[model samples]
Target: MRKKSVIAALILATSILIPTHVSAATPKAGIACSKAGLTRTTATKKFTCRKSGKKLIWDKGVALPQATIAVPSPTPSVPTTNADLIYVAKDQRILRHLTASDGCANPNAATAHLQVLIGQNWINVKNINFGWAVTFNVCPPEQLGKKDSLAWVEVYMDPGTTYRWVYTGEVNISNRNAQGNGISGSTTVPLPRPVIDPHPVEGGYGITWENIASRVQDISAAAYTDAQATIARNARAPTAADNFTTYLSPGAQSIDPNIQDSITLLKRTFTLYAAFPHPSKVFFVGTTLDEKDQTYAKIDTLSPGNPFIKNSFDNMYGINPNLPAGSVFTNSKCNGSDALRNTFTWPDLKAAGAILTSFCPTDNPQIHVEAHHGAAHEYAHLIQIQIYNYHNLRAAQPCWMTEGEAEWAQTAVSPDFSSYLSLQHLHPYYLTTLGTDYSVPTNTVWSASELTDYFANANKIATCGATPQYALAYSAGAAAVEALVAIGGSEAPFALDQRMANGESLDQAFNAVFHIDWAKAVLILSDVVAQKMTHVNQSDALTYQTRP
Candidate 1:
């Protein structure tokens, strides 16, 4: 009886222990799990609790062939920081950063420096310093709205190493006063050959190996050249007058007895521009008649025998090696047109001349007026070229400004010649296709983008042939100038040119003279163009009859 009682007690203990061990729930696929990474083993399979599309659920069990041993995962490696990227933002601001997350967060103050290449040597940029502890640092703005080949950035990484980023491409800074945000051009990676423990020398940004004195000299020379140009510009007022002479070609007299009348008109045009700044000696030669069979012999006889004049005639009619490459005037004869030449002789004797052709007294009254108008236009170019030379300005002014100002100058000679009226008459027909149409009509409304593009491509248009597209510089360009005149007075164009000659860009000059931004000016001009287009009538078309 005692042995039977002990066996009953052992069976009861086993039943209580087995029920306690089986109390926990079994894991099944697609069922909610209490904890992630939890696993369980059954007789047939092993299941794991893992993330299944945002929910912690028991994963499908893996078949258990035998008892398995678990192994731990290897540790992940940390990523190193990438080299710094430097680029010019669309608005012409220079920016530097390590990565999207990592910026120029330097702990040291004023360690980030900006430098500019002034000839061949890099010199420290003056007046602006980068001291901010931010993701990216904005370098000092240089040559705003224009490409600058001479700018770069440097940052001190440590006492033993300094990272440098040099722009391999031209960088243009924003014309706006505010800093730019997005990159505009190619990004430059940090130099592979790091600057090692570079010592800051005078006038250089932590570049001990460079000849600091030579760099200083280059900067000084550049400043001196600018100063000289400024002095030359200031020496003559816009209203100052200069001397000029006129000569008529033999063909001019042979073609028409009333050629003297055209000569008189040419003199009048010269007199009109005499009040403005001009080259010291301007020689006006007229009438290379018979457009298809034109010859330089007649022009040679009529010219003042000045070597510069001869060279200009050669360059205009024949191929002169001295002529600038891609010059629009190269082998560009005045056979069927008029032109201003010898601008290359500026600031010396500064010999310049106007070659008038295709117009004679024998032509109809309207054609006669057009001929004189063309002469007046060429004379305006003489004044324009002299001003450019005085300042030693190298960049060609925007086509709109160049041609529009010339068109406006026609009225300066005679109110009978009105560019404003001519453009008004044509505006209605060409309003919808201003940029696309080859007529280059000035009467259409303008967008900010179109104006910007026109301004940007002014040089290219000036250098190309006189396609209808090139005429935009005349028509629309005249309208822009007329708008400028209406807002800023007649002296506005001259003042704008003067400002540009003094080293300010067109945008800068426009803002300074008009007290308005380019976009704002575009809006105002658009309204002006729209009003002219809207007011068009039969009488307005008649007004264009007087246009030269």
Candidate 2:
């Protein structure tokens, strides 16, 4: 049998043995189903099933009215948006064991849950798209079949564009049998197309267009104990390869205990985090020695804020000379002809809103998953740079268009964008307020989805006329580009703008361009954008009338 099959068999064998401890044959209690009032229709009632022995019984669901369940109380650290209330139970899918719920274990299953938590939601629909971290109480390891089951749960919905119902999948109890142990699960579901409008209300649609696959995480407990000792030994040698290797070299020399455990805790906590539905590649960089090498660390001599080394190379080694120029890098040393030039272009940095830096254990296997998701955002930049170069139009491209395209492509490459497209809910203001100013300081409390909408709307404006205002230019221009792509397919007229800029022309660009029907494309793009906007406007009007 293949290694994967063998490993899976082992997992199944272990799970079967672990959960069978409960001798009772009664059905496990399952959760009750109720609409959260976040979606257009009620979800198939979800029940929790704990092993009662021979059968699984229905347990009382969390008792709260669908609408009342989401009633605003204390604000969460993360802003509460339309997406927060809507929980598409299917997206919570994962396959993980209880003890292996975190670190060096299965990351694909873990990050999948995280992606759901971080996802943006549509307006009116009560569906929630969460990302990264979700903590739940109850469910333990030792209790397994007796009273403990999986902390992670999965709810299956009907496969359709309308509000339909379907039976729930297996209750994913954690492989571990301890209370407060984490678990993860995932599944796919179809959402309805907009019946009312297409445009967004507060800003633009909070759409998810990216996912990650096949992540590797490795973490060590000992490495944390002698962090300083590890760093000291590695710093002396400073071999280029050490930059990448020291991360997991557990017994190299001295180690730090506290840091090591903390790293382990983080790994365990996030292991049950969901994975990105689609991810292209993952690269996790680290210091040469087990100890944190201050010389090449994210907090090196440069600035304390940005957690990246300046003269770093490819996460593996030096840059690939044959590759195209302008790739992102955490460290740069050799100045090859095709080095990861400077950081993102001025326009990209301007549009990024806020820059976030994260630290991870070099040995943590799941670290790569985060790297893939983080780096995937930059891949869109690669495309943006390439396409725009083809057009030779260099004035700061609209922030919305570039970012939106990047966001769109992240999902486009894997798992597919269909899920995000279906789940997104937009506001009308996104269209009417096209070319409006909405970007606030990154520190300011503003909605990420709303800002994206503004940027998207601005890009639409840029597509129609030259010198679209910076505020909303990118959003409008991108929409216009989408509109153009719809009409002409990928080979349409404006398609060459980037190529033309790159020194290609109407004829030459034709050969290199994609081919999509122009008429149908235009109709689809225009209709979609317009419809989204209409729905947003209606929702907004109602809010206005009800305001005291």
Cα-based TM-score, every candidate: 0.45, 0.26
Candidate 1 whole-model C-alpha lDDT, 0 to 1: 0.44
Give the runs in model 2 whose Cα sits over 4 Å from its true position.
1-295, 298-374, 387-393, 396-401, 414-418, 422-498, 503-528, 536-548
Q: Give each model's whole-structure lDDT.
A: 0.44, 0.29
lDDT of 1 by residue, 67-115 (tens): 6778888876532222243222232222222211112222231122333
TM-score of 1: 0.45
Which tens-of-lDDT digit does each residue in 466-547 have in candidate 2?
1223423223333433333332222232234344333332234434453333333333344434433333335342232111
Report the number of the highest-lDDT candidate.
Answer: 1
lDDT, candidate 1, at 79: 29
Q: Could you tell me the TM-score of candidate 2? A: 0.26
Model 1 residue 142 CA deviation in Å:
37
RMSD, each candidate, Å? 28.9, 31.8
